[model samples]
Target: MESIYWVLTWACHRRCRHCYEDRFRPYLRADLEAVVAEAERNAPLVLGNLPKRMTYRDPGGPDLPEKMGRVIISGGEALLEAVRERVTYPVIEGLVARYRDTGGVKVVLQTTGDLLTPAIVREVAQRGVWMISVAGIDDFHVGMEGEAKRPPSRRRSRQ
Candidate 1:
């Protein structure tokens, strides 16, 4: 099976030292229509070889198509506050709704949970999108040149 990864935004709240986007930058707004079209085109090729039709419940509590595609909405932390102008809750919600409405396209939102709010989570969660969440071991981020920088945290260490 093949996968389609789309970097919808490059803006982020945290200036992580390890982030390549922080240095190079990403400016293009993802053309969701084009992405969906591509997925539709590839669906025919993939449908014929599905291991088996997997049945799953949709947002509205209906069965999704046996042959479906997965669309991952990723970025420099999707819910980052710094890039609010480029991406917002409405923008994300609309994109997700459109994709889910198309049927059989599993939507996944990848985030670091920096700016994630309960309302945003509820909205997206009810739409049937899968979440790919991650957290760092510490507040430090390794720089592009291998230097590490740590952020000041209000939370106290256990030790």
Candidate 2:
């Protein structure tokens, strides 16, 4: 099934050695109301905030009468500094909670998994939001963050 992806924020706690989205952050991010307003603005022109408009049988056909499948909430790291910078943990929880409360929208979270605390895990579980951890893929995208500086003591001896 198709999914609707949303980048909730650009703030992350880890300055990873391969982060491509490192430069696109604001010093301060939007609050929950702003995020909700933004979500409302781009929402499909249907009741219950459903994605019934994105389904299509043909490339340039009319709207289908089916649901759009799933809603994926992602970011630089949603549960980490993104929540810290923009809204509080509860606010994001509320956002996911909305999708959870919606009968048709299956909510999925794509995150780095470095900051999934037990409390956060419990919250996600309680809200029935599925999570996809992406912490183990840093090596393949090595150049995004460029060469990292190393201390002389820990540096490898050059031949």
Q: State TM-scores per candidate.
A: 0.48, 0.50
Pairs that collide in candidate 2 are none
Q: After superposition, how far is residue 34 of candidate 1 from its true place, in Å?
A: 22
Candidate 1 local lDDT, 32-58, one digit each (tens): 334333433443444344323222444
Tens digits of lDDT, candidate 2, 1-159 = 356776655555455555576542333445544544443443332223544333334355457445435566666566654353233344335445455534445567777665667877777667656555555234443322222233346556667
Off by over 4 Å in 2: 16-18, 22-68, 81-103, 140-159
- lDDT to native, each model: 0.49, 0.51
Candidate 2 has an lDDT of: 0.51
- Kindly report which residue pairs in candidate 1 clash with one another: none
**Maximum-TM-score candidate:** 2
For model 1, state the Cα shift of residue 95 in Å. Answer: 5.1
lDDT of 1 at 76: 55
lDDT of 1 at 58: 45
